[model samples]
Target: MALAQRRPPGLKAVVNVAGGLISAIAWRRAWMRSSRPSRHWPWKDTLPQLWVYAGNDDLFPPSLVDGMRAAALDRGGDVRLIALPDVSPRGHAILQNGRARFVWLREMDTSLRA
Candidate 1:
């Protein structure tokens, strides 16, 4: 509600507020429904064991990844964050373009084998 007031008047703002409200309501409903089940989400009881592979130029800020890492640590979960320097969100594509697809394939193969 506060967010809706801050936006300038336009179709985009109206759409955004409407979308946000709808999404919020839907998410609340889903969360309530899911919680009623006997089964628990693993992450709730035990911290998620997260393997975060993020690029510097991801659409989301790096702080988001850092926040996840912090939250995992707070919950006593193992968090492995691999940072690829000089990499963008499209870094893999760049690697492929540079004919480093074989390297990527090898890494994937090793990971799968492990």
Candidate 2:
């Protein structure tokens, strides 16, 4: 008679599962503010921000990101809204590969140094 044995998933599988769960929770928390109409965050002008959005991003469309960038600028904040060309629709996936990723890293380095 032959018997079948089952083994637990490896360390990488465990980490990936844990990371996905954590990411989902974090995304939910961050997006919760979108449902409230009366809530407004008082942004400081001292803090600089780099808003990276894609034209094909269904989540945060170009128009919405533009408005956000305009709002930040109106508040005298240092903000750069980089609209990538022909990028992934995932939006966040823009940083996963290509020249845009390197550009983002360079910008971050410069921002941190200044």
Candidate 3:
């Protein structure tokens, strides 16, 4: 997702597995709805994006990702975020557990097909 946003030319598709630019900074915990990141989705002119993140992901919690989603949507970026149930005690592992493959893969296929 981040890569496609950064390099938005002639890309086939994007699978953002708990990845983004705003998550790079973690010193503060603020709602991103009005944050600069919320308005910084550069993919509005590009293809749709698939974002897969674990619910218990401490690195990119739902609170933060939700705001990002809202922001991207507001900016007209085609992004679908699949907030999966807690897959592992690790909190940041997306595919670490075998059970989550079906759900994530399904979403991925749909988003990729778009």
TM-score of each: 0.36, 0.53, 0.77
| Superior candidate under lDDT, 2 versus 3 | 3
List, residue by residue over 1-114, the lDDT tens digit for candidate 1: 234334435412111101112233333444346733212212321312223232543432344445444543554444444444434335333343333344444544554454
Clash pairs, model 1 backbone: none
Candidate 3 residue lDDT tens string, 1-114: 557767656787678887877544441244333356544544463457788888898888887778767767777767778888887765577777777878889888877776
Model 1 vs. true fold: TM: 0.36
Weakest 10 consecutive residues of candidate 3 by summed lDDT:
25-34
Model 2: per-residue Cα lDDT over 57-84, one tens digit each: 6555565455544544665656655567
Worst 10 residues of 1 by lDDT: 11-20
Can you give the lDDT of residue 100 in candidate 2? 68
Every candidate's CA RMSD: 15.3, 13.9, 3.1
Query: Once superposed on the true structure, which residue ranges of model 1 sit more than 4 Å away at CA?
Result: 1-42, 45-50, 88-114
Candidate 3 overall lDDT versus native: 0.71
